[model samples]
Target chain A: MASSPTTLRLAVCLFDQVTALDYQGPIEILGFLDPNNVKPDVPTPSYLLEITYLARTLEPIKATAGPRALADRTYDEVGDGEQFDLILVPGGQGARPEKVPSSLLEFLKRQAPGAKHVLSVCTGSWILARAGLLQGKKATTNKSVFKAVVENIHGYGIDWIPKARFVVNDDKKIWTSSGVTAGMDMANAFLEYLVGKEAALRIRGIVELSAKEEGDDEFAEYYHLL
Target chain B: MASSPTTLRLAVCLFDQVTALDYQGPIEILGFLDPNNVKPDVPTPSYLLEITYLARTLEPIKATAGPRALADRTYDEVGDGEQFDLILVPGGQGARPEKVPSSLLEFLKRQAPGAKHVLSVCTGSWILARAGLLQGKKATTNKSVFKAVVENIHGYGIDWIPKARFVVNDDKKIWTSSGVTAGMDMANAFLEYLVGKEAALRIRGIVELSAKEEGDDEFAEYYHLL
Candidate 1:
């Protein structure tokens, strides 16, 4: 990586009934990965992120809440040959295996395998597991449904940690986080890993927000992640 | 209020170049306030929040980032005769006085005065101040550019606090927060103030996220907010 790698193309998955924060929180944090949003004073990172919202179509994907994000392109549009630098998948009530669109699963299987980084927020990890990308990798998911989701998806050779804030599989190039807002924390950790502490610190400073390692995760105990 | 207020109308303003998380974070947190997203197992709050995205037009309001959210109605369509239970204002680089649309100022002037709650996230407080809504009221804005923005809009009778995470003016029904993501903390604090601690705690538990009172804003000091 040079002082800046010029551009890092990102493919962000959007879907109906998606939990908006799962992806939105991390997306905002990762926006700092874009060089265009950089300030002159901040120590520049090695790459700039250019995000493209991907869905089944170009229409607005309705989130579980009233909020909706208009997709920039469809899964088919990317084609099997198109390789993204990063792939971000978010989760919601609609993320259940029975409810997820086949196109989304097929798209993930094709793109995520070759992407530089594959990140999943909340139950999005479940989707990645479904796509066979989580096999032989360490990952985590939304704890509220962690046991049910992980148990249902067992036998994939994946190490599922219910009490983790986020688990990174540098070997597999996969990063998975617990629950919704935890995505923000994972994004921060992943950004620091890729872009260095100086860049990550600048973003947190500007936003008056923190991206920290919150491993206590009381929900794990409450939900009995066993 | 009573055992449960039943319904609470919300007007969330969206615009081109708006910081998505400024409003998105709040919207996700407040989704619990709406009856539709509530689960029977999770304890319900006293009221249900009904949100309506109000923009300059009914078109898709583009965020500075790649995401875009469609507006449910327009400012002109909201009309002064219609009063919202709450008015949520989000900010971005485009939120400056010279850049904000006149229609937004007109809409705020007409609507915010009568709304049950007037909330501003990030530099959204700057917009409220421009509309004369923050006059003689304690408030804050995005600390990254807080001092300069506050100084530029001086003589609005604004008691701008550079270090505060968020401030509440119960008499004026105004709530202002710092920077982009601080809106979530403010939202958490405001929810507790209005609906009670139990509801706020439950929501935090369910999401497995925490928003703290970060008043000693290091960004304010680093940026020389003094």
Candidate 2:
């Protein structure tokens, strides 16, 4: 929001059985916001992101598919008034109602209210819906299991879109995406919103990503969600 | 190669300043090979991958941008005769000659010969090239910094291809990909090779990845590498 270099604190939520790609895809795209990784001649970057990986504890959190990721801090460790500019919740088997930790939902309920923006990858929206954040909101989730997941989570007061790669809330405070790799596409658009199109394009160019738009989802049709 | 279920051990090399996406994109795609994630009625999974993250030390390996990854074992801790079915080398700022650890190169040199498949994402090929493993082999690296990186690494004798998304040598033992996100495409193709086209397609469909072929690179033209 400033001409001078500004830093945005990002809180990445991690839990056991979390899909590594859900967080990794977005983190990889957003990592380009680091000024050190950006070109020196770019004058001032719109924002330099400072990322913090949060988990229930400081121990290594095992992903659904294998590979363990270490968290920087525990959700309980954050002070009462502490807030971040961005919050990321990734989905996996851990996102199920029975498996999802109440502590995480509580953390999100606290942090999301104060955060500038909240993002959920795949069924992470399920957790958000479970936490009552998605009530009266428009969102989408992983399509392969769309019917099964969305049908059971009744009375959330959410408008679930079936044929979209990602959907943003009317207020623009919340962003949600389809299955795994869609996080990268959502993140590309999210970066464009945060920085500018030019900056986002440069980042995507370096990573060689052909950013797909919100309406460009083919999986929606393939899965017969449309 | 067995008809019955078989687990392939994967060694993921990590270092300070390594780009997270370089490995994450591929690992995410490859993780689906796990039988647990696969449908029970699918009969038999071609291969189930067991991933092991390796680093110079047991401490968290900080990436070039932000966030840190924990390693399962130190390279030295791996037994002398131990072998991995698949070895992954990911690149970032740390992949440079001065920044890379000697121990990593030594471990790669020792491990690669015994590996069934050696994969390098982004400038991870630089590491492979530096390890003297790319000699008399065809390969590709991240295109943005391609010229500068390959030019300086003299006498590796690698037939560096400038206009490809990824390259596989005559023997198909080594696979090198262009830039960060291109690793996913490489992994997609690699999955098809390891498993079957049907299985890879199912995995990609669930992840919603519109797989890109080897020559579907626009970066080559964008960077004037062609």
Candidate 3:
């Protein structure tokens, strides 16, 4: 018998001061791509895309975006046997190394084993690093905060890949992007992976977003000339 | 005689689908405050503040928070002669209203009279509202769209208010708050002019938010009962 198509379960982590765009950009894209919203003219196959705000507890988490956002369930709500197709960690001021709660770190550690893909935006990589997930993975962050991430964290064996606008370090099942807006770029890439580039491109056209390459080739070419 | 510390001229106008809470609520309080964020540690001085977002223009505007916002400024700019202490507008999805160009609205209006106050949060309220003197309006944004403000538009509005639970609608002589946050509750009754006791108290504590009181007790009891 043919195996049933796997449903994509995406959990976006949230906390106080979390940058609004970090989640909003990707969320909006995902929400738009949702089969429910697809116009009759568009051909979208049925895909169970479940996006949830994974918080530490059931309490409503405040977002940098004006109103508070409530999570569908707490980190503890998901059982050990449960698996997620993707785990998206959005960055913000709240993702500071010192401020990330232990509960969140523990949740990250527990979920990593089952997550088919672990993605992060901007400083969100910091939290994954805290969870010991980025030890050997290549990652990136906001350009301004790049230096601090390199100097502040020690002995992780992680490849500090600066210069690249965004990096896909598939070896660790981790994908990272620079700054907050780039989260949409990364999400688009992931969407291409799930629904094929054509569908992702269609969504991009609908949203009026420009296509962005994953790595920084212009800088690399400039440095080579020198 | 000194003219009472020069009235902090503040304005927050209405627009269609404009997140009513975003503009009205914040402007209400900022107009009532002393401009220093100085409260008596108690909510008592909820009596003095003057702010307005009058539709000086006939331009149809859009808000990022929801739908369209109407502009009060009839002229291209808030005339060079009339300097305002502070000027603001809110954001909604209306920023992209049909046949309306809010950016043009923002571009034409000059800052009130002098180096008056200028502010906005969430979307391009700062860019589209046309608050003059934004060249140096120490400001923070909704975090998600800060880049659009900082990069797409030039000049300062950049003293990022990190601690502000909302935007501070601050201009040389004015202040703004982030759109749709608790700032609305604070704006409605606590800003410059006092809003009666019961209404003010109802919005302040976040409690009794749903409790509806139709007119005053005497009016309801005596008139309705009869």
Candidate 4:
């Protein structure tokens, strides 16, 4: 049954003071798609995901929330020749600052254009926006920092939605989700789109995520983002 | 607020090929309680939690799913006197083998008893059981590996529940959850129990977790574990 073999290259951007859940939520829900994470008895046939953790530096950087992660490659190393199919940028207190890292912004600006899909969780969109990539793009951000993001990124000419758990630009294939846990919801939906509803549901069943929905979030109302 | 001071020490155990989400989900949810993660505008009044990551070796260990993390301390370094208020053990492909490392089992055996709360996510319960910790206790494991867990650890006399997302022996303060994302749900419930519903709800609102519930799991039916 195997026909043409393809490898999906995913770049998970890491940085100092990153939020653990924003990136982790998406990685957890979607990480299984990495063919390397296979079940021995289940007969998955084959694996197709090739993940690389990219950061500005090679050193281990601690997130503001907790947990220090080591990047597999630096942005400069993955600079020119290498390109990705998917780029996932997760936000946190680090992204909350007005002066975001130049290297990070430059990396996103450089690599995101060539990728098939550019996804951001929470404030990561702010990074993409700072890179000038989200200009004329529809996106959303963490509600806890709702006003801050809405206020800060207005200069980029991006259309920021107030009440979405996530927003997608069908034309650009750029997906952005609200706060920490909301990324998981968005990821579950993205998985449904990437593989098929049946496969996504199969994954949700294993994780026991019965209540995850595409737009079933309440933070917009709770935080008065709407 | 200045009248009294208190600190809660938490120890998160890490291992080779550990699932990043399993450890990260709980860390993300609970990391906020660690006073250092305070928001200046939020006025949390004061900080009170200290976290330490413990592993068999000080070197970075790669999660079976993805991401490499650094442990704060080696298990040998965190000797008998260094007790913790909470101990979290997350499971992964690493825990599936019959012969897990003796040091990790030894560390859990030595440290968990002294903790106010001992929690395991997904197959981490298997490690707790393997350490001879969950005997005569109610617990659960990853539904995908349900038969493996039920078959492997039956001799330990654990009351393995098939349907619950998470099960806790209130008196013992032992909490165990199903697979992967179930850890986030368990963490939300635990936050509610720890800091009161209002505070937990506040945290949940920030993260925008809509479907995180203690018993809101469906893996048993999906996996045919029941």
Candidate 5:
């Protein structure tokens, strides 16, 4: 049997103080689809999940931990209307600054227009909010920062959907999740959507993600109490 | 108000497959001594918690997540007869290998002689066992690998304490915990030992880890049945 075509471009936006796990969780899961690991029955025998750290420049981005991660490409490098299959924004202290860099906001706005899917982990949604991409959209973030996201960003109508641990809004084009660790959960959900439930489950088993969508209700209950 | 003489030298060991959260959970709490946020009265100013990765060489260690984390120093560089206040080993697939590298095992054995306290997260106890440090000692690892740690290693007399969620044989200078995520709990337990319960609670509050330790019983009840 002939192997299926591999074509999925995933660009993860990175900046100072980007939560390392947020970007790592998704990248690890997707990168595991190496050609060597492809099963015969899989439609996409070897899915090319190309991950790039979309930044303003190729400078080293400092993570929450002291280590600095180098970016693969700049915003302009992938410019000229090149469409990506998925665009991910990670959240951390970096997202809470008083002023969102205009270049970053413009880059995000432009990326959101043509990407097949736009996702945010924790306060990464704040970036989308500043870019005017989350207007009237249901979203979530680090529970502590939820109020900040809602009260601070103007003209970005955000319906704080506290019930869903992670919310997929506006027809799956926009996805947002809660806290630093939930990035893995969000990635698993997206994998389930892109591939199938079984593939997602297989990946989850490999990664040992203890919490699932079902447990989201428990998280919601805790969130309410908090 | 001279700061109390620094007593503890906390070294978070890094190697292939080291879980980031395992090291981060304790380091975040111990490294930052922000008393204003948690407890005002506690006089436990942050000690000199030196975070370093103990690797065979100066080469960057590959974490399970694929990113290369550079170590500050190699095991050999620490010099002969150097004593550590505490040594932390994190769990991951790297620790589960049939044969622990001779260099690593030698380093662990040598270091164990002078360490004031030793802690292991998830399967990190296996590395301790390979060094003959767990002989005649009670310890635990991630529930999945506990049995292997007991039965697989030869001439290592471990009690294989099964009931406790996390085991600390203070007499034996050994601390072990379950699974990848339990590093946080183990770290908290260590802090409680060194700085007292009040200090531990304060750090836990800052990290938002106030929840009760998720014991092995809960893990078995949920996942083992499935």
Candidate 6:
């Protein structure tokens, strides 16, 4: 008899002025967890992820670009104490440390301890840093604002990797990626970690995405952040 | 004084069971048109896009994955006679030729005649083909479903390119891309076509997306479509 697939609940944080790609990209890559969606009809992976989009209100959340997105639930509905298997924070105009909401920080602070994994893309790491969850951890953020993020979030003691497309702190169950589209690369790596290389490779092939390694980041050098 | 930015209206098609990434990825690349969101803040491009998401109705449109997306208008709101500068169609379960709404086909048949550009990603081309927009035009679709799509859509007389990431019909102002993530690559190229190489290169740098040439498709060979 086959073993039961592990069900992972995911919380995707949404906010006004969020960059559409920062979160949407990862969702696209990770969405292949549903076996029916995978091309060539691959067997079900050992893990299945149930995604929930959360926001402060049920109102439509306007992104920095593209169409607005609707959240599945509000932060108040989930409460700070609710634990999820995975928590995703995506960066955009709203994620600027100064612009981030106290509610998001408080929610992260309350949930990170109990979450199995916490992931972020672009300046989403700034929210994680501001929440103090990345203290003494290795992480990366959007390369364009790399210096500003590192300077602004003083004393987090976070090792902000300058030359990484994505950083994974296995000990802390945290993954951080750089910029808008890098989230897809990080999600690809995360998929490999959750399932295996073969499954990840299959999805990558289906999507026709060329995978970039953690150290393959050229933006760090482009922005003189290295 | 610099010339006033040209406002190009965009119509994004949405439906139930649409693939989030299929549409979201291109929007991320193209959304850089809003000068305020660009990193390092370059001068505004000559053309600015006003995006409007169009669906059959105003209710939140659920994608095949991730959060639900809200449309800016309904098909009735835009009417079949409305014209747009650009029209984007993304593919997923709902985009199957048989599943697509006649309202969408009518909208495309009406709009494609006057739109500056009409773009489709993944199985989105199938919708175009069914709408008779891609008749005798060069195009491509998701490689996993390439054979089925080509075989299924009969008498379109479309030049289906098996060894390409995206296909552009300059004469017809039609652009189609392969699979899901390939939309980003096509959008990058489309950006160049709209704003010039330098501007597109800068946006690519900010987003950390490496450009892929239209002929750089590996999935074609992977699926033996080449």
Judge the docking of candidate 1 as incorrect, acceptable, medium or high. medium
Candidate 6: lDDT over CA atoms?
Answer: 0.86
lDDT by residue (B1-226, candidate 2, tens digit) is 5577689999999999998888888987888776567754333566888888899998888887535778889988888778988999999889999999888999998999999999999999999998989999999998888998888887778899988889987788999999998999999999999888887877887778878898888888878887
How high is the lDDT of residue B36 in model 2? 61
DockQ for every model, please. 0.63, 0.64, 0.03, 0.72, 0.21, 0.76
Error of 6 at B44 (Å): 2.5
A54-162, model 3: which lDDT tens digit per residue? 7787665654432344566778787888877788887766899777767778889888878888988878888888889888788877654667776777687888776
Would you list the C-alpha lDDT of every candidate in the order shown?
Answer: 0.82, 0.86, 0.54, 0.79, 0.65, 0.86
**How do the predictions measure up, each by TM-score?**
0.95, 0.95, 0.52, 0.93, 0.77, 0.96
- Candidate 1, RMSD to the unseen true structure: 2.1
lDDT of 1 by residue, B59-178 (tens): 788777657789888888886567888999999877987778788889998987778899999989989989998877999988888878878997888888877888888574999998
Clashing pairs in 4: A35-A47, B35-B47
DockQ of 5: 0.21
On residues B87-177, what C-alpha lDDT tens digit does candidate 6 reach at each position? 9999988998667877888888888889999999999999999989988899999998899999999788999999899999867499999
Least accurate stretch of 10 residues (summed lDDT) in model 4 chain B? B38-47
After superposing candidate 6 on the true structure, give the runs of residues whose Cα lies further than 4 Å from its correct spot: A35-40, B35-40
Candidate 4, residue A75: the lDDT equals 84
- C-alpha lDDT of residue A144 in model 4: 83
Which of the two, 2 or 3, has more TM-score? 2
Task: Calculate the i-RMS of every candidate, to one decimal place.
Answer: 1.8, 1.6, 18.6, 1.6, 4.5, 1.3
Question: Candidate 4 residues A1-226, lDDT tens each?
Answer: 7554357799998888888778877786677777766444432423356788988888888787656888888887875888898899999878855645678888888888888888899899888888888888899988888788878777788888888878878774899998887787888888777766766776666666664565666778888766
Error (Å) of candidate 2 at residue B211 is 0.9
* CAPRI quality band, candidate 3: incorrect
